[model samples]
Target chain A: MSTASTGKSLAFTAGDGYHDDPPLVAGNLSFHEVTDLVALHTEKKTPMAWYGAFSIANIGLMILLLSVAYLFWNGVGVWGLNNPVGWGYAIVNFVFWVGIGHAGTLISAILYLFRQKWRTAINRSAEAMTIFAVICALLFPTIHVGRVWAIYWSLPIPNQMEMWPQFKSPLLWDVFAVSVYFTVSLVFWYVGLVPDLATLRDRTPLTKKLRQKVLGFFALGWNGANRHWRNYEKAYLLLAALATPLVLSVHSVVSFDFAVSIIPGWHTTIFPPYFVAGAIFSGFGMVMTLMVIARKVYHMENIITINHLEKMNIIILLTGTMVGFAYITEFFIAWYSGSPYEQYAFINRATGPYAWAYWTMMSCNLLFPQFFWFKKLRRNVAFMFVVSIFVNIGMWFERFVIVVTSLHRDYLPSAWDYYTPTAIDVLTLIGSFGLFFTLFLIFLRFLPMVALAEVKMVMPQSDPHFYEGHGDGHGAAHDLSAGKPESDRGKS
Target chain B: MLKELTRETKATMGIYEPRRDKVYGLLAEFSDPGALLHAAEGVREAGYKHFDTHSPFPVHGMDRAMGLGNSKVGYITLVGGITGLAVATWLQWWTGGVDYPLDISGKPFFAWEPSIPIMFELTILFAALAAVAGMFALNGLPRPYNPLFYSENFSRVTDDAFFLHVAASDGRFDMEKTEQLLRDLGALYVEVIEDLGTEQGPAGDVRGEAVEKAQA
Candidate 1:
């Protein structure tokens, strides 16, 4: 019975060889211990180390707010968005940040659908990343509009002007797409938080009535009723199912902003699939970057194991290959079409003034990910961190090349001009990261950085019938008939 | 958490008094899932319809033990998805075709092709939002208070212990009998759940306890 099909035997015992080697979660944790460990982050006194990071992140948030203020006060013209290159750093940053958010949904929704148990370790933080990344992303379009006050016009709300956003416009589609994606993500994230919030509520000593009240209010009076779980499970499954399509459609619509246009490089049928793949690839890169630091700083190595990192690396490799293939297909299509404008768009991207940026995209996305093929490199935290940074940088340049190159030299040579980001343009891009990291750091400190409820669910100790108390599922890994769980590890 | 909880002794004070409206239910705690699962079956077998099993996370087969039917959240989502599709299609068709018909490039204003993306997104959005709201409604959530909170031992319900609570309002519920049944079924501790007593529920209603029982 090809071991894979006999899930009863191997699933709890041995997994894909990678897991058998070092277990997905170490330091065998019981239902109670896991709760204590995970909840400790939120309930404990603020560590001095946390304050150090928080201060740095606050400075970043301040920079983000100032840059946004500048953009809104001066208008879209404050950036390098001119007549010929109307879509500049702003659009590039918008697409880049949006792409980074996709990995979060993929981990929480798509992985949940596929029943990837490994996701239990990383889903909370990944989802948090997605929320913050989207928050940073929402800023670009608002500032890009020039009239930030009239941003509400982008929505199909009833007003005295009787104005309706043109349904034909992809920009209008983007407004719907991003907003819906954000709302769904927030709901999904919040729903997952309820059970854990209850845990935090329960853990709060009666002495701290204030903390209990605050946490209890949001916990929604959850007593972990079995009936409530039944509904919660079904609701979560439905949301995951709904979010699965959204993860795909949201990026597809974002890709439409370019593909619907007549611009040679932008108008391609392969754009949707290509953008989706690129988004996952880049998003995973950010996940890796954040997770590596998080696991180290939080002493979460027991839960966020090396095996988990390896699985994510494998995905990065797969998506990176798909992206590289998309790049090649774009070149082939440009040449095959025999349209001089398309050919020039492709050729100029490589050999023209922007070749440096083009090569940066290629090396970071295509070349660096190849290193992950080495199991050792992929498992090495330091090496993986550097490589993930490279992937993110390359993904950013990929957008820059696609946006700037296509618009810098349009069909009319007279209108062609070299696009250069003004100081505001550069600062705003940096400020978006400032915004993303600021939100992320706050989430890390205040919220349960790891999914407490989910992590407990994965523990064999949680099963009523299993008495095996080995922290890493080792006891159950031996026999299905193991009865009467003992406290294998002493109470914390 | 690191301060070594000053209220650590909130475990149980023995024979918890049910001070008038303060009583919510009889909460029986089991140290492990095996005991809790068995106790859940006993609670169901005893015909206690308004009882539930609570643990740090969901336990396998606990639903069957609690005798709960499949959740209706999925159906709610389906209806919500259809509503969104209808709304999106109707909104798009009316706005583009009838309300403000501006023929730009001779393409049909209500073309089905371009509308699919919005349709798909809207359907997903509506369905997802419905699922969450429906779940919260079904579970009677956003509730700031539950009498279970008054039992300090119940806090471990989210940590190490597994508990089966039989509400005081259940048709089969008699406090002494249910407590006896639970203790016999391997309960490490049995504590009476008491309310915060911050508000009264229409004279003798016991609002928090009444609402939870009424759902069952």
Candidate 2:
């Protein structure tokens, strides 16, 4: 279960003269051990560090509440909104939060369908992150509408005069896409939690009758009947299948909000895929940022091992490269098209007033993740942590570059102006992080952060042939890929 | 003859019911999924119909071992998806094209190209909804009580233990013989599950009666 590879060569498996494949659950713990370890976080006395982190998060939440209240009182004019640069920090933050939400669905839905057993350990908390990020994302559009009271007019419902929202607008499409994504992701997350909740219910002491009853009610009297699992597993597969496309479509629709417009920077066919790639890049960054701390604070190193972090770093490398490719491709197309405005937009992004923001994005997103190509650097906890922070910042700048740089320079030179975020804009952005972490900390304290039931199923003991002494001759010390259930094996 | 007829009528009407002390089934515990799966296959091969295996997580190939066909939840999901597609199409067409048409920038009203995102979202939304709902419905979840809960050892089924329950309702059920059969199939421990003092009726009716008793 050691995460360190001893082989001199970079090989994937032990059989081919390379170091052994690192384990998913590093300690070779039993099912009971896993259950106890995860449940302890929720059942035990609150940790001192948890109190420290929670207070910090609460301060952020307070700031968010105050800033939002101020905005509502004074109106959108209080923030920095000029004539040419209409879309500002509000749109940038909205996109940033939504991008952060994608990692959860990717880990939960896409990875499950691909039979990646390593996903079991982190999927639960990652999905929780997705839900919280979406909540923060939804806040922007609602408050940015200025007339929050009349936001219902955006729905399909007819107003007093029978006029409906413009169906052709990408803005309305975004509403439907994001709402459905949230709803489906919630159901998927809850369905996965049922069995784990049952474990908590069963383990509750006699004195905590209230806690037991609450968990039991939510557990829905689950008895782990194979008849139920037969349907439960099928439902899970179906949801995963549905969510895979749903995740892809959600961000593509968001991109359409920009692509459908006639702006030189926004009106490009590659925007959909480009945006989707950028989203996944940023989402994984956020996941790493939280997970690095969560595992250490909760003493979950065995469950979420260095091997898991290494695998995630590889993904970051791949997606970061894709985003970088899109950045270059945009410049190429601008030059190839011979359109003066498109050329100017791309040139201006690199050499104009916002050149500092553009280069910061390049180095943080493109240059920093390149370190992950070296196995040692990616596996080093401190190095990945710093890169993840850079990823978060760079992605925000990516959105900023897309929204402000293009809008600041319109067709007329007289309309050109540099847009800077006011104190409110900066406070609101910081406050959104406050909202995300507040909900996340509460989840960590209350619910099982790791998916206990799913993790157990990935252990060697869950294999039917394991007890017969013929479990691939690996004994109990097998890696996660080796411990995959029989039903998953034959398919591939 | 008249007395016999009255007794039959009362039994049918649920007025005459068996005592709660009756054995519900034989509950068998296994050390791991392998043994439990082998026992499931043994039970199925023995032609025992009302038997089920329990564990913390779903065991692979369990359906085949227990002689279960593919789950019917997919059919429900398919129907839900189709309904969503239809509804989304109708809503967009009626609101934009037929009801109150708009001529903004000379774009057509209710085109399928622009409507694809909404349609796709709704399709996934409804399918996911039906999949979860149908799975719960098929599994008969949220039942306030089950006779299996009467066995103290069965509590571990949600954690480290594996279990098999053969219902007394099975046509082939014989209390002593089934217990022996489970032991032969290598159950680590076995116990007789009994229906304790609870309402002896449909799950819904039992829930209603229990709630009333609690309120009183």
Candidate 3:
């Protein structure tokens, strides 16, 4: 009781006993220490491992570039496109990358609105991932159009050609939806980075004049004015609120690209919700994959502790379960509808030509995450990392099954053909990952990977009343036990 | 004078103003947020109108302590959202139904159900843009030449320390009295921030004085 009043205890003393929830940030770190932990990665000399990874990513980017060039030089004919299967790896990769983009916004926007303080540690990098993933996502659609030059036809801008894109079409909606998603997400990420940029600007040594100026320019000369913080906080809140619905809508619109069609497997009411859940599932998986590596490489084990990894695992389990439920519901509805074509589609997915892909998706997305049900497995970094990789593979196959399986064998048996991706298709898919990793690795090198200011705000020292009942014990007490868990005060 | 000139180079481009000898404010750096919060309350209680607190992060209860009400950024966001909705609707309706009508599946040229996605996306885009832009516009940021930056200790406001500044523009501001009041509030450091005049050499003396006071 005496220790509780001192405000030095890690867990608050509830009525019965100690309520010891795991701290969001491990280790008793000071504000400056947290800043140093994140900023060091950017400020210090680039690690050899970063360069190694960057080179590999760049090679992927090169492959992507060459593939796109070849695709343009020839046409969509370079890939394995037939009468029934016009949509191939391009659409699957588009949906797959777009799904990966969801977790960042989910972490930055939805979790923010919920006041899940733990999001502070991971949100910045996650948002960056979202931006890069969306970039990769947008790449497919842009290049997918055989005539990349006339892509502007998708827009509503009046031109010499008086015709407008079909406004009623879900494809048109996707163009607007994805582009707007990218723009708003960029703005949100930048806005959140401003304060942190200012910190970096101040810390920059005078010797690095150019670095300081660049950081200063983007920082917008932020002075940490409370007046500014008032408006800034409101703006952040508003953006988060807007992004929450937008995140859900973006994926739904993506699913519309398929679900709006009359294809038996694609035409289902469950697609939108299912797609959104699967996007979040895949996104968290990607975030977990990157985070596990980044935290280890950057020596940020304290800031991004096992607790954070476990929490992400919990989300993975929840979304993975939702995705599996959707799969069953879609199959059940197909049979329940008594539509022969629909029944055939579902049956073919499981026991037909593409059954291998379907089964692979079922196991990876549905069964692999089941390991997270155990506390020990969820906390095991290596195990979670492997499952995360599986999630990525499974989610990609899920899209592949939906797009190719449905289209390859449609309403007519004569249209049935085995769809195999050409080497170009494989190269382009691999290249998109290169582009994603390159952008991500660059972000790691230049920017504060963690939200320093927000992390500081969560530290106990940020509380205006932290020292009210205590004496000289405040400094050492806070330094040693930084994450005193907002207590039962309920503000966090 | 070198200090003042060096600080100016860091100011945001295209907005440098050279003013004659004038006091920017008295900046008091507190060791922790609690001290700054209490100090802000004290300053408010003493009826100062042109005072602001600065910290590495937004201290909870700071707005109320500083008497700032709910931010107006939300209103700006609302306006932006409505504008986006209206524009998206008009763009879709006029372009699809009236300007260049298409007969697809015999569906109506214009309908709310089909238009909802675009409308919703634009609403969010515009609202988010307004929120960020409105916040920057209200803060009068990107004006890098804040006189407070001239104080070396002020840099830490973006780091670990908390600070409060009572502007010289305040109606009740008295230099000595404000400095003494901040000290009474147990500020770790108090220094007079000056807007260096174009007539420079003597500014060096003022800079030295500020540094001495900060050290005290």
Candidate 4:
């Protein structure tokens, strides 16, 4: 323990030491680098595969819009909404979109708080996914009211009509919850974009003055100062902390829309946490589906990285397991609680007229993510893509099971009636995919897919050690006589 | 004019000759941050201002040794949170209270329990917005240029380098004395830095230069 004249130990301590090696420069794509990206998007024209996908999406969107128009022009009676089964595909899609929106907030907020560096690569895209998914979700609830123009009547304000929204209604809670969720998520997404927008502002050679002005305004004149970096980091951390709870609460409130009801399967204590887990599971699945396509099309494999995809797969697996657990626990509780109605509801879900949907939900949400337990399977992009599709399918069925199954069979046996989707319902459902993809495609074309500044922060070469060895015997003294040369330290 | 006037005044006042302080020691490099932090603490204890430590990354305790205080971001977040809560309550009250009231469900109007979700969301919304906005405000962002970029050696910040700069701005900062102090504090190299007086250029050009330097 010989202390140097500097009054610090000169001996090397292996575990307690801090290695300040330079950040590794994997590679960076600057603004100029995006020319290749633009070329791929535009000059490549529409590939035969993309053409098919786009056409399918467009057709779906058209059908959906047409159905919506029909609903608005005609009424809710256009679809199969009779006595017992009031809610239909519209509500199902709303829940599904809300669930899909979960992955974005989870990726941006939860993972960010944990200081998961891999999040930098995928957060931007996921945030966009959340926003778009929410938009898609809002459509269903708005149209589901039948009288779309009278949607404002649901608000709590004292009006000339002398009416006020019911304080106890779960639907009203949804109104506030979803709106607030959307607003906060939007702000979070925009704030995150500020630094990146500045990067883009500097990078894009927009000859048009309006483009420059608009970009400049959005960028908020970010200069990336040290003080700015410090504040930005703090703000980002705080936001992440705020958002973490919001993510859990929003979906739980959505679950309350069903759980608060006395309608057998809908009224369960486990719905909140279970819904949140299922939301995350399905959301991650959507992320996987989108990421695979985006990475391949944009040729951004280096930035997106295998590590990111692997981490996402892990999340999918964990959440999928949680969903499976919830499913089991719901059944077990129903049987153990000795509630005949609960038992009947669970049984009806499995062996009823909509048993196909129930099984689909079970296999897709539970069985697909299990493949990720194997490293080889998790690494297989195509396999993961398939699993992701299955997860989506399962999540859709989960909503279907919650809605259609519960309503199809009530306590009053005389009121029980088989419900089936009209062709318009199916077409409208297909059109939602079109709406989602169209928005996504537009986003991909314009926005920076990757958060460049955040990624730069994580690169190895950004470490301070590269400048440590300059000057005197001080370098030798600091090396702790571990016998490793300065050159060797630099190499490592 | 200011420099000449200062020199003349110093000569007239007969206080021109500054006291010479000599420091002597062997300087070393710190590739490991723990060593750098230890050295920083040692220097701080020794009452040295002309010495600094460099590392490839920011060590957890390094700021304390460097005499930095806790970041003020929490204050911003707190204010943001309050604002969010207020706004959320107000929005719900206004919308559900005054904007439009309908009896869709057979429940009382202006429900507070359901409003909790919106309240929670707004709080987070404001808090997050404030955090980001506060960060930009505090950090003085959108500054496209910095004086540090003039030094080619500063590029190592993005790579592997932890540097403690003992600028002339410090009270103990003298050419020889600072160099000797750095030597005593285990600095591997102590170099005198000159402030490049190119402040009169157009802001855009300066920004371009900074960008070019960063890219380089």
Q: What is the lDDT of residue A216 in candidate 4?
A: 67
Candidate 3, residues B22-67: lDDT per residue as tens digits? 7777888777787788999999999986788989899999999988
Ten-residue region with minimum lDDT total, candidate 2 chain B: B207-216
Alpha-carbon deviation at B140 in model 4, angstroms: 6.1
lDDT of 2: 0.84
Stretch of 10 with least lDDT, candidate 2 chain A: A1-10
Selected candidate, larger lDDT, 3 vs 4: 3
Q: Determine the iRMS, in angstroms, of model 4.
A: 10.5
Give the per-residue Cα lDDT of candidate 1 at B98. Answer: 87
What's the CA error at residue B212 for candidate 1, in Å?
Answer: 24
Write the residue-wise lDDT of candidate 4 on B87-201 in tens digits. Answer: 8677767655666655555654466776777678678777876776676555554433433433344433322334455434335445565455445655445443333334745
Instruction: State the DockQ of every prediction.
Output: 0.35, 0.41, 0.47, 0.17
**Ranking of predictions according to TM-score:** 3, 2, 1, 4
- Chain B TM-score of all predictions, in order? 0.81, 0.80, 0.84, 0.67
Lowest summed lDDT across 10 adjacent residues in model 4 chain A is found at A1-10
Clashing pairs in model 3, backbone N/Cα/C closer than 3 A: none
Best by DockQ: 3
Residue A142, candidate 2: alpha-carbon lDDT: 90
Tens digits of per-residue lDDT, candidate 3, A337-397, equal 9999999999999998899999999999999999999998998999999999999999999
| lDDT score of residue A205 within candidate 2 | 73
* lDDT, candidate 2, B1-216, per-residue tens: 998666544322112222245666777877668778999999999998778898999998899999888989999999999999998889899999988999888898878998888888899999999999988887777764666665656667787888888877567888678877888987776777666535564322221111001100
* Model 4, runs deviating above 4 Å: A1-59, A156-159, A206-211, A466-492, B1-71, B83-115, B136-216
User: For candidate 2, lDDT tens digit of each residue in A124-214?
Assistant: 9999999999999999999999988889998887679798877678999999999999999999999999999988888887678688778
